[model samples]
Target: MKHGALLRKISVVGVSAACCIALVGCGGTNYGYTGGVAATVNGAEIQEDTITKYIQDFRTSSDLTSDDDWGNWMKENSFDPATVRDQVIDYYVENELKKQACDEKGITVEQSQVDDEINNMKANYDSDDAWKQALSSAGLTEDQYRESVEAGLLDEALEDAVAGDAATADDSKVLDMLNTYYTMFNGAKKSSHILFASGDTEKAQEVLDQINAGTLDFAEAAKQYSTDTASAADGGNVGWDAINSFVTDYTDALDGLSVGQVSGLVTSDYGIHIIKCTDEFTCDGKATSLSAYPQEFVDYISNIVKDQSKSTAYSNWFNDYKAQADIQNNDMPENVPYNLDMTKYDNSDSSSDNSDGSSNGASADTNADASATEDSSESSNEKSSDSENSGQ
Candidate 1:
């Protein structure tokens, strides 16, 4: 996904398309641009206006206006005008690439197949009217949402192109991806967090030390200085999640730790995290690992992982495509609002968390070093996992 996707931000938008369309569902008016073609793949020129509309629609739909927010988000995540433009070209190319792959292998998605998929989507909210209303409020037209859905379908088709061929070179990750949701959903995860806005390592470590020494009240300390306003105010509570979206460092620290165990600050592109083992919930009324859950949630986890695997595949495919395509960014900003340094991925107050369940930069991203700010309004999308790339 790191290489194939234009930027991980799109996955946030696209994630809504999959699990919760009402969340981070950006649908906006077209941004005008008749400056000719942006790039061409095998002589197929990508229309400048189409590319512009795509970017504008995403930006406008996301409701990102502030320079600091846009710069930080764009700089850190998987988005940039040129990067996105090339992604579109890769879509066109991959569509064709998959066509060749599928045709050579004789695989397909029929009208009825697509119809069933769309029906399942419509079933999520019941009635086209309700679905349309949700999309409308999110600033998207039926046409745009349909296209978004189609792209998702296309990504799936590419995967189905070689679903279970007898090749020794198997990507068990694909099976793992396909089955993640089903495994974890069956079991619920009862978890809690310790909020810390103090980017100071000493301060964060002190809080961890107190908790380990059985002195610091997890909820009390969170209320006092945790930057996470939302959780801090409400007891450092992050409701049940079938999958762990946190970085490896954070999860590894929590491994084998029993309920009531408090962890040390774990670092990531976002910032430091002090995860607490509150309680574990299960559909069967028993405790289990985060990796194992109920059948239904496990299925959900499967699709989540599947989509991510496909996303990664798509990214890799696109990068290879970009190498051959001639993309001249004649109008590229000399020193744009945010320098696209992969190193400067976090916001200015990245390490700040509070007991209030809100992060200092939760509502913003200012090109600093870390952040655990969750977007309450738009939190349902499948976040693009970071996989460091040589190119960016």
Candidate 2:
């Protein structure tokens, strides 16, 4: 994801496949290429155009425009075009391998499924123009987009087949898995804070005193005095998230309170805070029988639990294949010329809460570090959403 987040921003249009030849020189030649073969995975040649189209697709999805925009993104992310191309090549190699596995197994994606997916995607836009604009932004033609969707469907199907009965494990097992992931997937709380920050304890105490005496509202105190500028503007509304997303001290204090209840002075590395819980939700630490839930609810959670297996199965297959495959990549230069310095980008604003009630990026829960759980769960959650919404 670290590479993916940055690679999504940088791409080149009209760059020749010969550019790879010129850039890598002779030491990196692979598969004895004569026809712009970017790499070969298990004797299957991944064409240069394949990686190029993917680059363009990434560019479009990120809403980056023109050579200048891409150049600026390169400068911002400290990446080179060659490195971006190489990353795409690697991904394409993996994708082709997966496709091959699907083919070898005689797994075929139906035309109706692909058609339904395309229609559903089109419906998300208000007009054909808007849909076209989206495709243009993603550097994809209608046909190419359809191919991508078909590939995605095939990817899902392959994963499902590999993951086997784990998708519909008994309610107790499903619950255990759910309980394991709940801290990551669903252990979130919404709260308003009045963060005093480090060295502001005196002021923090003053604000707390005012709130206790009913003279100053928590929201007013947050806007007027909290040092965390990002959430301070929202009246210290940190939105919803698992408590463990923050430092233990901070989260422990938050965990102790009931909804709508205010806490006394609390301290953390971020500084002191008078805390108040706005909304709270929790899963029982224990898993219950399927009979305890509605059929619809059981079906829904069952789908989510199963979704986790998809990527695992795909990865296991790919890893095994890669271990034995005759892979020859011209993408990697001996010295690896690109300088990828991640600290240059502002990741502070990365958290996004979707209309579908999914929140990603930094937890808006506390203005603390992004949760480790969030990172691991986000991709699987997206996959799950796509699978669920495939025909809608």
Question: lDDT of all the models against the reference?
Answer: 0.47, 0.56
Candidate 2 residue spans exceeding 4 A from truth: 1-35, 49-72, 75-78, 168-173, 176-299, 331-392
Best by TM-score: 2
- Give one digit per residue, the lDDT tens place, for model 1 in 1-392: 22112122223322122112211112222334445555444454445555455544545555444455554555445555456445444444444444444455566556566566556556556567876775666565656555555555555566545432221222354344334323444444545665544366778888878877889888787777566666667566554444445545555665655677776676644455677777665344233343444343444444544444444555566467556654443343334322244444454445233357443222322231112112211123333212111000
Q: Please give me the total number of clashing residue pairs in predicted model 1.
A: 56
- What is the C-alpha local distance difference test score of candidate 1? 0.47
Predicted candidate 2 versus true structure: per-residue lDDT over 258-364, tens digit per residue: 88888898877667777788876555545465553334334545655555554456566668877887879865333322223334333433323235855422111
TM-score versus the correct structure, for each prediction: 0.40, 0.47
lDDT of 2 at 299: 50
